[model samples]
Target: MDTLITLIRWSIATYCLYFLLNNYISYFYGISLNDYYQWFMLPSKQAEIEKLPLIFSMILFLLSVVFLNLLLSSIQLKAFGNFETYIYLGNSSLYDAHYIKDGDSKVIVSQTATITYNSSFKNIGLTQNFVSNSSVTDGLGKPQSAISMGNLFASLVITFFFFIPMLGPVHALLSPMLAETYTAKGLNVFKYQWNDSFNALLALKGFSLAKWALSWVAILVLMIYCTFRFPLQQFGKRAMNLPSYIAANQLIEAVPVSIKPIYIERARKPGETQYFKRIETSRRNVTFRFDKDFAQSVYVTAIVDTENNNLIEDKITSHINSHGKMQLKITDDLGIQLVKY
Candidate 1:
């Protein structure tokens, strides 16, 4: 089967990359690959890898992903759909182009017809260093969600240095959370007045049992959060009682739709720090976060029809309230804010 063959070749290619990078990536940071592997990748190295300068450290992180994509091409593996397919299987085909001709457009479609599109992406850049005024809170009133280069790479960097000791398989299951924290709260260092990266690494050696336990709890919680995920959609149940607006077709209809914090991330160029941009698909997950002390505002986007998209302009507004004790204000077009208690 083509699927099985793809997987086989993909695995071989990825293992090759791992074999190469696992031995050399740390070299870019002027650190020992073995120490990083044993201390951080194996036992969450108490921030030892952080010893490298921050920018250089992030550079190494960035290069590892860049190289992974580059190596994928060497194996003749091209990703066709979502990253979940080729990423684990080793791939270079995620970026693609196609010429689609409408069956009925032959009147104007000939060999001379050509179309071009120019765009950039930063969806892959390291975000643990992106300082922002945004925030998200978990059920326990703990805010834990925000934008990032991606959870996958974020965890990859984390597992290489900070995850609790575990087998390769276990690390695979828990790496996403490791990266997310640094990505979302990378600024926590500035916001909370924590020590620098080097001290954090040194201090981690004495992390209390409670801290270790909390780390695992955080990982499990993030896993469960996305477990029942759904796409960020317009017609389904969202925005607290949104389904009430659905028509007989069980879909929400709007003349114009715009979602604030178009959070998938921007596309980027090499050497410019990039993050993964999500290709259009029916699958998506929406996360509601508190930008500040409360849910100050929520963004809504709907596509009633073609030829209409108004996000930057303020044509609509909304609000959210619960338990009668507090109400969250929301501007229809912008994200919530981040403020101290």
Candidate 2:
């Protein structure tokens, strides 16, 4: 799964790079997408008539693709690495625990459950409650803390160079080498480029139909590579096993569990009745049973101790008037099985 996801990400990144490069060329050289197509399709006689300029443009496009890919790969690695770290930390006890001094409690356990449903009147409402003990963190060492004004400024400067017409590709090619100097000095050169504002701007600058199609094709190829290279394995294995480990030690009588509806789509038909039962959890698995009348699809998430304590999450689509039972099996070897009956 990780491999597949990585491939998808790379594929998307590749297309995005191509799109940006194409747009940059169009904006600077007044060349259209059709012009590129024609250049490749033109007969030898026609090509010979304009050989010099055609060769130059082709060379420029190829160079841009290579440079852009380098820059994009770095950005993708950093961005996805940070996201994976956040997921790991968020679900771990290190980030969710409450340090109680001199208290009999061996570990702080927090549980919360939330339910959301739309009424027959077409109004959506939510109910959430927390039970048992829970505490907030000092907010230190979070991923967000990595972002700073200096990083923002640096990102803006690097990104600005990419839009400077003829000079952009040169900078894109050289920027990684330049960034290595800072990296050797224990600095995060690409961290600044993760800014949301900068990403939005980049997306706006590169939006194009040809780019989208190219990106999709890239995604398909990457997906195939990742599927074979990376096998399906449970993500956050240690964290997922914490409950069973604590259970085995007999340090805690029960793992604090929470089941929440993270998202709920509208009912398929107006005034359709929707039914949901409280989700149940145990050391071995989490179970969700829905009644035949359920009308909307819901994305349900389960947590062991806190809201950030994600154990398993699955999307449940409504099949009206059909009884549904879904179970997520948990094992000590970090093996996961989703059974639907």
Give the best candidate by lDDT.
2
Candidate 1: list runs displaced more than 4 Å.
22-35, 41-341
User: What does candidate 1's lDDT look like per residue over 1-341, in tens digits?
Assistant: 65665466566645654555554323222334364444456455454333334445445444444544333322232223111100010001121111111222211111211111101111111111111111212111101121122433333333333223221222222233333444475523222212233234224455443564566667655544433342111011112211222222222111211122223444775876546665443321111221222112212222111124343122222211221111222223321111110
lDDT (Cα, 0-100) at 202 in candidate 2: 42
- RMSD, one per candidate, in order: 22.8, 20.8
Which candidate comes out best when scored by TM-score? 2
Candidate 2: tens digits of C-alpha lDDT, residues 1-341: 64675577556645765677567546533444455555536465242244443455446555444544434443444354332111121111211312111212232222211112111111111211111111223221212212223333333333323333333233233233334533576644445542332233244466543554455556455545544443321122121112223211121111212233333344445564554334334322222321222222112222222233333332323211233344444333323234322
